[model samples]
Target: DVGCGYEAARQMRRRGRIAPQHWPHVVAASRRLGIAGVSYEWLAGRAAMQRAAVMQGEAA
Candidate 1:
């Protein structure tokens, strides 16, 4: 899900990426999704766990 990156992901306006104005909400959304934290490694680990859970659900 793009969430707030829909426009950027689609390359709307030729930016092909998120604009500066969207940073705050993007970071907020990332935090809410458990993908952002005090440590980059922590975030990666959490994301891996979440991804595995999602894939497991799909397999089920």
Candidate 2:
């Protein structure tokens, strides 16, 4: 569940997204889970691509 939550946050951070007020919660969770080597930029790019795909699907 921690991984899923973190991925969700990463996706949400794409496309000029703002940091959530509860960001501390995510940090705490990641620290607790000992998650390492996370790359925000990569996640953002991936999320942007996913968002584009969804948008294209809707348009189609």
Candidate 3:
């Protein structure tokens, strides 16, 4: 699922890790799969802090 991949990417980014550079591929895949409301920029913007909060079980 695109949503799952996106979340995994976000988590990878959060841990100061390097995920494969697959944004464009993911975007295309999402579009083909009819996954709507997927904004890469927005996801990237919030990823680090969001992941931190989620990992810690609290608001960032």
Measured against the true structure, the TM-scores of the candidates, in listed sequence, are 0.39, 0.40, 0.42
Question: Relative to the unseen true structure, what is the Cα RMSD of model 2?
Answer: 7.5
lDDT of 3 by residue, 1-60 (tens): 334566777886687543436555666777888888655774575667667778889643
Distance from true location, Cα of 44 in model 3, Å: 0.9
Instruction: Write the residue-wise lDDT of candidate 1 on 1-60 in tens digits.
Output: 325555565673463334445546656677777874634454456557767888999999
The regions of model 1 sitting more than 4 angstroms off are 1-37
Per-residue lDDT of candidate 2, residues 1-60 (tens digit): 233466666776664442444444545666677876434554466558778988999999
The TM-score of predicted model 1 comes to 0.39
Task: Please give the range of 10 consecutive residues that has the lowest summed lDDT in model 1.
Answer: 12-21
lDDT of each: 0.58, 0.58, 0.63
Compare the candidates by lDDT and give the number of the best one.
Answer: 3
Residue 33: error of model 3 in Å?
0.6
- Compare the candidates by TM-score and give the number of the best one: 3
Q: Give RMSD to native, each candidate.
A: 9.8, 7.5, 7.1
